[model samples]
Target: MWVCPGEADPELVRAGVALIADERGSVLVDAGQSPSHAREIQAALLAAGLPAPRWLVYTHHHWDHVWGACAWPDVEIVGHASGADLLRAEADRPWSVRYLREEVLRNRRLGPSFRARALAVDSWEELRILPPTRVFTDEVELPTGVLLRHVGGRHAPDSTVVVVPDSEVMLLGDSWYPPPAHLRTPADEPDLALVGRLLDDTIGWYVSSHSAPMTLDDARRAIAG
Candidate 1:
């Protein structure tokens, strides 16, 4: 099942979070934007009668994708090797400490309840960086049939993709998106060749973090035009 804020709300864009489950356990892909977001995810899991995730796989080290990971400190987090380094670097930055507070303030401008619900942090000190427990250079397979691959893209050096062959699902974390003028940049665009190759595979569902999930044919057309 996928857990997301639905549409692009002011507090957060359409960040996608997925839960892949099997008899062995469940894996959560991409922790959401804040602690409250994590709580939302937890509630969804409980409502669905699914077990708490045993593994957390990140697509990249972007703030939105990794910040809420601390909410699941006991889960075995996995991601690209470079992501681990980036997480450590980001945590060391002074601005990182202020991010949650700043976000809460920004949301407050939207509305008080929005601010309270979006961020549950009493102090920035509550925010802590939780690096991946297992970092892989290329690919690794979990017993549940989820494959994590380090598919670097223009978005981030540590961008990864989660593939579930049996389900014909491919979760592309901000790796590929319809080109927009404001976001267009030669240095930070997705790798078309890599995307084309993945699209050519057996994937039926193409899920992205900031956009609605698309069918394989729809993805191909989006890339073509």
Candidate 2:
């Protein structure tokens, strides 16, 4: 009963678009904002017949995406090979350094946003950086009754997404958001080109980690966009 649907994190609803599931021992994609926020996601999953999660999948190292991952059982978690570095970098840069500026104190315009992140953990070092149980340079597959493809160059250098071919479903990280055509910048813009080629080479539907779901044709069109 692995549920993969669009969800929101109460703390930062605007930035949250989660993917949670429970096929065998709870495998949640993106453990979410913090432990409290993850509990909220857990409640939702429970209400929908899914249990608390024991494992997780990090789409990238965005603080809003994978912070509370530690709260989950340190089962066989997975992500891109570069994911660990990205997570480690989370604690490297100051909370204020996210927005490049003359100096940390010189930046005053980012007050509200600053406060939100000021509370963030300055170093992911104590957090273990959550290594993937199986890291791959190019691709990896999940044998849980589906073929999961770990893709790079969608959101971050360590960005990744999965696809269940038989179900015609794709768990696109931040590579794409459908039905909306404004914010489509990716770590690898050329990835857009590859998306079209992927769909043409195969037949399936696509679902983003954040926005609405799309079909194979939709993926091709969006890739072309």
Highest lDDT: which candidate? 1
Tens-place lDDT per residue, model 2, 52-93, is 655566766665567667656655677777877666666565
TM-score of 1: 0.81
**Per-residue lDDT of 1-225 in model 1, one digit per residue for the tens?**
555533466354436789988787889998876665678888888898888889999998876777778877579999899989989987886543355357546654424423433344434555676778898999999878899988786667888899988788999887764333334556555455667778846789988887778898987887786
**Lowest summed lDDT over 10 consecutive residues: which window, candidate 1?**
109-118
Clashing pairs in 1: none
TM-score of each: 0.81, 0.68
